[model samples]
Target: NTLDYDYTNEEYDLIYNPLKMQGKKEVEVEVWDYNKVGKNDIIGVVNIDILPSKNKETQIELFIQPKNDKGEVQSNLNTDQKLGKISFSMIYIPEDDYLKRLRDAELKKRKTEQELIRQKELEEQRRLDEIKRIADEQRRLEEEKRRQQEALNAQYIKGYVQFKNISVSNLKKMDFIGKSDPFVLFKAGESSQQTTVAKNVLDYQYLNEEYEVLYDPSVMQGKHEIEVEVYDQDSVTKNDIIGAVSVDILPSLNQERQFDLFLQPQKDKKDDSSKSETSSTNSDKKLGKVSFSMNYISEQDWIKNFKQEQLRKQKIKDEIIKQKELEEQKIKDEIQRRLDEQKRIEEEKRKQKEALDAQYIKGVVQFKNISVSNLKKMDLIGKNDPFVLFKAGELTKQTTTAKNTLNYDYLNESYELLYDPAVMQGKHEIEVEVYDQDSLTKNDLIGAVNVDV
Candidate 1:
């Protein structure tokens, strides 16, 4: 007998009692099956015992095809089916562990990124802080240097010096210590000339300590060559003849006088004869008629010219003195004007101070709860009036009232009374009134006990 089974759609098939059996015992049956299976066919071999506790019941399924044209079973099968049972077991996995690990990794990555970001920010901040610190320090140093420079500049001195004297001759050598240069005036005959005698005399005080020869009146009056010297600070004779001066002196007045008398003629012939005899006796004298007359006229002209020059000099002196007096008077007037202006300013300041003091005194009175209205009624607002005291609780509940109200509109010139519930304890209400600059009452309000103590 032959049994066939098919296992195709998740089902098992059994084939038993094959026609060709091979076994030693009668009860033990061997089945012959193909080694290979075809599509959806099974191939295998098994042995079984029918009786006496069958030799472990065996089953075989074959997957075969017709080997010949007669349709015989083939030994080789070509199928995806087998005769053995296939068993599968499933394992359960928890997502928490993997999720936790992944979360941890993600958290670590985030932490690292955050740390890197924090470090970068810190580095950037440090760099900025360093730059700012350096800049601030540089600025501080520059400011210090500038301040020091300014101090040094302030330390240097800048000023001017002026000196005046009647004449350069009146000035001593040492007087040129702080002077720049000196101007000299020479009055030769009737003509006066001004000249700058020396420049930077203090710089050349060595070799040329003595006055220049050109400045000497004796040399200027005589016909001779005069040399001037310039020296250095070491007193060494640097240039002994830096400048030269030539001068020619005129005839003396005495000689001119003697020649003038010799030119006069006698008034009578008898007198002339006597004079002629005397003149003959004095013939050896160095006076000639022509020379004597010329001398006489030159002497007369010199006298007239001298007097005119003197008068001119006097006029010039008077003019200089007048100008000096006018300049001095102007300086005095300016000083007096400044003094008067100062005094006026001082008086104004004093008045302002007195006014401020009066205001301060008035402000003090407001703190003492003194009746400002009574003072105002007495017209004693700015009179430095004495303080008035009120009975402890005499007017406590008088309940003053106000009309209109106080406002910030007139803050500049308005006066308003303020109430303190702390001081007006147990009182029903407090009222404030506003008054105008003319002391006329403007606003008042009704009192109430709504204020907190």
Candidate 2:
């Protein structure tokens, strides 16, 4: 029907929750006021149009019109009728975006969760010092010291793995080349990456590549194996795997250990009968050998100390960042304090300047000429008697009563109103009110003029 409720001081808050406008892009929202004393009256109504864009955000404005019954428009701003205005701007988002917004929020939450998961994983990794056994530490250190002296010439080494050479097996001479383009591939760990391949070993330049591995000593003590494979690269066909080799990672942390890794055929290939020269060697060719050496240097103390230094630097940086944040917070607090002080001063000035009245005024207030017109007929004889009392704008009331100008009008009277300028200043209105002298009845205020002094 019609909305009609008087706005009271008890209920000042007006909040409109999400007005789900469905999937419609264009909708009209109307606001009406129907609070009259005895009946309902249409104060105003406005139609809101929703304008939405995907790439850019926008805003819209609608004007409200005050209307009375019979759909006629009216304006009441200048009159006593105070049907206050309402600023209505509705950004109608379609309900179809509910899932989109939910998905976006979910995506953000998942990303945050993923980052936290990675951080937890890094923290969970086993540390060397944490796993180092206290009982065996002394013996391990003593034994590592002896190896350190032996490796001192290389000087403060971490660890190094050397790949020497590879012997092939069941190798087929690829195509018309009559020579196999052969190379060896080797790596450590589970991931296929980190494989150190041999260079310059087309003939017999063994021990071509070296890989320096950083391992946690106190955490890792078991033998880690190095996997090696030999490949025959053909120009036209897919590369043929000659064989594969598995070599154990060296155990010593200081002195290097040398060993020979035997290679075996990865897959059985058809025997070539025409190559009678290689047929005799085919049996020996199928089985091959790979020579390699792995070395380790016990420098856990140096690595540990360097890591500690880096951690100290990071701690210092974190402290600096924290201090910067605190300083920024302090600056923000200071700015807010200044703003609050400014607001307080402005409020004080507003209270003091509420009225255009004077704080102190000094001047002679003398009623030079006095006249009373349009006097109400009194005394029952159609005759009137009127006199005037002059007062200034003050609490004590700078007042002066003039003698009755008997009959209907007053003679030109000059009365000096003693005004204390030490108490008041600024504009003071001289109020001249006319009163009829009635000994039996109280004095009647017929009219008054707020005169400027």
Candidate 3:
């Protein structure tokens, strides 16, 4: 094939075959002027010779020789014939060396391609890691913001609700011999407060009993509903659930709210009565009714009003003292009056302290020498790593983990928990839970037991 070009200067690298020559060989070069007419015109030709004993590389200059149409060199005519000069280099290579060089070049090409692929993979991995880091940071920021808002809401007290004048009437009788001894359980969210039991009566009035409900996001999440349950007190068996009712607390936030809720019977009562011999006729009717009043106390306004009232009382007391001084009363009488006033103040303080002290009964409970036997095997390589957790009400404590033993004893593992009887009611049992510790995941529970305190 012929290569055509339309430029004044050009360069090209060419490879030539030795054609299995042993001693010497001859090579010819030709140039031609392409034409669109009939026959093509020859520009010039050069003849070269190659020998086996020549150098590896050689440079040559083009000296055009004129030739006839039959391809014979014309030595008779000697006019300096030249179009453009060209120079080239020629290298001689043997068969074995040529094959080795070809293989090395191929190997280098593959290594370069593999290196580029590795760099691209590393770049992609870095980009993915950066994306994951950004996502994690954003999640952390959102969690922090939520926690801060929750803290702010908990610190601010919106208002208070005074639940007073509480009473329940016409409760269902749980006992065969006498009327039921009933009590009211008031629960808001996870926290609960109850009134003292009323002994053996169909209707009961809580004269001096009152519950103060504070509005805070941490406790009740801003005016959530309150759940009321009535139960009959029993000596032996579990207490019987009489009825339940839910009271809305939103109205108490605006003004003094009054509630007259009719209690509904327990859900499983009808099913139990169906199995009983003497089923009452009023089983499907309303259980009873509860009447209560709630007075909303705005924290800011109540504080301001209380200070004003205190100032007014102080002024009145001052006026009275001035009038007593102007009357020219006896000195002994004045001393006696002052003594009586001091006694009144002391009595008031005593009553207030007693009222506060009645809220909780603090008690200390100690656990010691805890052990567990026959724990389930959780690990394939060794015995279970077991620990004991003691939970009483809202308090919890745990024993140290004993490693690689079936009959493990946590000797001298003692703990203490403070319990409030009023808040916990009759749920005074300590829950003992056994667990197997794991390094890669959550601890597995083995067994549990409850001990009554």
Sort every candidate by lDDT, greatest first.
Answer: 3, 2, 1
Poorest 10 consecutive residues of model 2 by lDDT?
271-280
- Deviation from native of the Cα of residue 325 in model 2, angstroms: 48
Candidate with better TM-score, 1 vs 3: 3
Q: lDDT, candidate 2, residue 210?
A: 53
Ranking by TM-score: 3, 2, 1
> Which RMSD values do the candidates have, in order?
58.4, 60.5, 44.5
Model 3 poorest ten-residue lDDT run: 273-282
How does residue 301 of candidate 3 score in lDDT? 65
Q: Against the hidden reference, what TM-scores do the models get?
A: 0.18, 0.23, 0.31
1-453: candidate 3 lDDT, tens digit per residue: 444345456555334565554443656667777789978877777666645325477786665677877896554233357644435666555656667877887888888778878888888888899899999999899899889867755544555656778898988778998998988887655666788898999799989999865554466654345667888899898999888765655556647777776677555644422111112322335577777887656677667766988999999999989887866667768888989998998898878756755544669779997888887898888988899998878889989988887788787678998777765655657888998898898998988989867
Kindly report the root-mean-square deviation of model 2 from the true structure over all alpha carbons: 60.5
Return whichever of 2 and 3 wins on lDDT.
Answer: 3
Question: Which candidate has the highest TM-score of all?
Answer: 3
* 322-395 per-residue lDDT for model 1 (tens digits): 98898889889988988998899999988985665443321111222223332223223432122222222223
Clash pairs detected, candidate 3: none
Query: Which numbered prediction scores highest in lDDT against the true structure?
Result: 3
lDDT by residue for model 2 (1-453), tens: 533343354412122234554553444334544555666644555443345533234454434555666654454233333444444333334445645866887999899899888877766543434455553787799889868745643342334444333333334444353555666665544323223333323333333445454543233323244456676665577877756654444454444666454455553347321221111243434445545555654456546755898999999999999999999999999999999998998988777765434543566677654566556665665454576777765532222333343333345557766566445454456677777667688876767888766
Model 2's TM-score against the true structure? 0.23
